[model samples]
Target: MAFRRDPKTPAMTTDLPQHVFRLRVRYDECDPMGLVHHSNYLRYFEIGRTEFLRSSGGRYREVEEAGLYVVVVHIDCRYRASARYDDEIDIVTRIAKITAAKIIHEYEIRRGDEVLVQATVTLAVIDKTGRLQRVPEALLT
Candidate 1:
């Protein structure tokens, strides 16, 4: 997703095709110390992936209804900074790699270019019966 920057703000472009999923840190996702709970980063990664797919002309539900689902097989998150309640964060995500049955996505969570978290996730396409399946070509397009 693109942020609506002030007209005076210069834009930065990159070769990496990515989606920016932005959200505010909610009270329920924060700890007593006002820092976001560590686990919530995983959720942000997922949101990043989902939005990336959607914005790129794919939909998670469409694939699921066709008997395919992307299941997280592995995840690694590195916290670089802490986020507290009401902090607006942008999760930048891209498809790092794709294979017949699996795909990898990379993510970086930022509060206006200051990365607060970075993560990588591996996902596999599987059917309801747990049989491996190929990712739809539409998703790769």
Candidate 2:
């Protein structure tokens, strides 16, 4: 599935590809309040994105081997509810947009039918020397 920016609105529109990753909240991921730590959400997003790419036939190791690295340039996450340890959650990752130099992803972390979090992440491709580069063709397709 290909995603394109809806010119009129500031949103991407298309039948975007999505990958769902399920995980149980770990005890260590929770804070004293028994809720998952805020920072852990970022790690969850990272894992979801990595698996999403791999499921699509791309690997971060392969990209790095080609002297390219994908880095998170920006991220926006909104916490809608709290997740406690031992809860089974599903992180749904979707490709929102893919440009020459960047790829944007949208995510939803849900417990059953309830959404716990929503996030958008922008990733940029760079060379070993930290110079901007176009996203690899293998990843875009």
Every candidate's lDDT = 0.82, 0.89
Candidate 2, superposed: residue stretches over 4 Å from native:
1-14
Candidate 1 segments exceeding 4 Å error:
1-15
| Candidate 1 global Cα RMSD | 9.0
- In candidate 2, where is summed lDDT lowest over 10 consecutive residues? 5-14
Please give the lDDT score at residue 96 for candidate 2. Answer: 80
lDDT of 1 by residue, 16-73 (tens): 5788888999999999999999999998888888888888778998888898888999
Per-residue lDDT of 103 in model 2? 85
Best by TM-score: 2
Work out the TM-score per prediction: 0.86, 0.90
- Highest lDDT scorer: 2
